[model samples]
Target: MDYQSIKNILFKFEPETAHHIAATAFELASFMPPVLNALQKRYLVTSPLLEQDIFGKKFANPLGIAAGFDKNATMTKTLHALGFGYVEVGTVTPKPQTGNPLPRLFRYPRYEALQNAMGFNNDGAEIIKKRLERIYPADFPIGVNIGKNKTTPQAKALEDYRFLIENFKDLADYLVVNISSPNTPNLRDLQNEQFIKDLFIMAKDITSTPILLKIAPDMSPEQAVNLTATAVEAGADGIIATNTSIDYSLLKGAKDFGGISGKVIKDKSFAIFKEIAKELFGKTVLVSVGGIESAEEAYRRIKAGANLLQIYTAFIYGGPKLIADINKGLIEALQKDGYEHISQAVGADIR
Candidate 1:
């Protein structure tokens, strides 16, 4: 049956349960290379126009499955088969901790949104590092997003990130330092300049892997730009323009806790992204993620100076066909704009 029909049934379960069910299916799929190849043949789009080198690695397309989906690095090949150009796994802590309490993942189907207080639940850095070692040299790029353990004190947070970076720096094509998730206590507090400078400087001293900072949407556009500027200056290789947003006003009856993502946060996410792009687009790599749900929106982000785009909530809502449709639509949009390559279209609006 179609994905929507499958989703209808899955939606009946709690959102977290549905996610586990999906992950289980992917685990099964991993045992069958033929099944994966067949899926890739259908879903994976390829064209020179969409290809580019970022972080010194070739990304077959600009779109990736965002970090939260594959927290332990198990779903890379499965996600690639589903047509993601890349997969970023984790929010992995120095040590594994059961994330916030249950009932943590909630869905708002009508709004194509999700509110999650999942708090970086994942197999810790060592386990995830082992997984990456087994899967590296795969066809697509991989990124590992690292966070501090819940019990790790804020003062020791740098130590957590340090350990994670040292572990996965060689395994991942890129590393993301996640200090923006609202679910982790005091994580957002690290968004300040001094912490960012220290973190990136320490990270650079440890590994040469391109490290990006994932910021939150709650900060003002100016604040976002200033903080990211600090990160870039401090040797961060890129910026992932948002994680989930803590602004509950975006959704009616939204739980006041956790962060909100998907369609509801699109405009707010873009506004911050656009402002950041306006200042730093050419200076540093900018990766945009938040509430993107269509080829049109993806193209809009590209024109606004995103070197890469990521989706999690929309991928849940749209499924495999959505990935193919986006790559196809991007080609059409690029041809219509008289751009020979996606790079030409990358900052068309700003240029």
Candidate 2:
């Protein structure tokens, strides 16, 4: 059967359940040589024009599967085979915690979005580190997104982040300080000045791997600037201009504490990116995440100064073919604009 039929069938199950089934199928597929080979032939898109060098590593492409999609680090190989230039894994906490009860993940097909209160439900850092060590490709760059356990007091959150950084540093190409997930209580407070400085200190001491802060789209302009300055002061390597938006105004129905993601937040996400890019202007890297699903959207973000782009909800709706389509579209857009490299287009709109 085709992917559309399969996705429809999976949608019939609870979101998390469907995710589990899909993960299992992918894991099994990764073991089959023929299937794996065929998928690579179909999905992998390579182009010198898409190459990006940052944090001392070269990316095959800018389009990637964002963090929340593979929370447990279990699907990297299949995801890599699907042609994503990179795959971010986690929101992994120091300890495994049952995320907010069932139905924590909700689909809003009407807007091609999702609201999740998954509360960092991941297989603790240690387990994920082992999983990564066992299978992560030697050269593939993996962004390890780490968070605090729900039971951990906000004051002691750094300890949890420390555990993840110290343990996963050897395996992860970069570490994403995931303090902006709206689903976790009081997590966003870490976005403030002192907390950012302190956290970056620990992150810097842990390893030389690039550290990027994931901020919420609802963060105030003042707060964004403060965090940006603090990150720059702390010698941060980059910023992923948004986690998920908590503003339910764009959404029709009500959700308790989950963060919203997808097309509805496109403009807002890019606006935040532009603000951060103002601070990052030739200094630190700016990676944009939110509401990206098409080649044009991807190019828009790039021109807006997002050196790298990521998608979770969009990836869910588009599948493997989507990655190919976006990459192809990105190349066409660059060539049509008379640009030889994607980097030349970065911040073109802002200028």
Candidate 3:
């Protein structure tokens, strides 16, 4: 079936149910080698020039599926088949929780953006770790994004993070400390200099997996610069430039405030990426994530100093072919700009 047709069928159900069905279907498909192979043959792009090494891991391409798409690591194998060089799974917490009330995920079809307040919902780290151990492939790079549970107090945040690190250290290619998702109350408070430094120390002592700090797009330029500098000093391997925006200006007519994602925040995401890139300046790996929908936008972020790029909202809107399309366009863009590989394009446009 075609992408749009599949999407329409999925959309016919409630949004969250559609997501669960999609993940299950993909998981089932992954078990069939022939089916998986055919899907990859049709969508995956290959290029020696596009291969990239970030924080000691090599990726076939710089494009990855951002976190929040596959929250439990249930379908990494299937996602990798669809063309993402890497698939980041989970915003998994230390304990299982139901998350916020339903209708948390809202669609704004007219604006091509989504507003979600999922509140770090997941199957929890231990369950995810066991499941990952059963399904993880040696060939693909999959990162685990860990979050504090809704019931966890801010004072004990590091304990929550430490629990996951101690348990899932070997299961993930890298570790993302997600302290920026607005859905969780006071979660972003961890972004403060002293708190982030302390958390990194705990992470460093337990796991050698490259640790990446995921920050919010709502931060001020000075705040981003300070946070990046602190993270680097504290031994962080990289920074995922954003989670989702809490700003509602993009949703001028919308009734509620949920995390805003898609084209509406692309420029803001890039600008934040550019500033963070300039501040860190070859010192840390930067993974840009908000509002990327096309190759041109991906190219812009890479040139602005993002070592790797991630997409969620765009993949939802563009369907399965998005990754291959972006990688193909990235190859052309690299050639046009006299770059040999994605790394050469990093910070090329930054002043």
How does model 3 score by TM-score? Answer: 0.97
TM of each candidate vs. truth? 0.99, 0.97, 0.97
Better of 1 and 2 by lDDT: 1
Ranking by lDDT: 1, 3, 2
**Off by more than 4 A, model 3:** none
Candidate 1: lDDT over CA atoms? 0.92
Off by over 4 Å in 1: none
The TM-score measured for candidate 1 stands at 0.99
Per-candidate count of clashing residue pairs (backbone under 3 Å) = 0, 0, 0
Best by lDDT: 1
For each candidate, C-alpha RMSD in Å? 0.8, 1.3, 1.2
lDDT of 3: 0.86
Question: Once all C-alphas are superposed, what RMSD does model 2 give against the true structure?
Answer: 1.3
Evaluated with TM-score, which candidate comes out highest? 1
Pairs with steric clashes in candidate 3? none
Instruction: Give per-residue lDDT, candidate 3, residue 247.
Output: 83
Q: What lDDT, from 0 to 1, does candidate 2 have?
A: 0.85
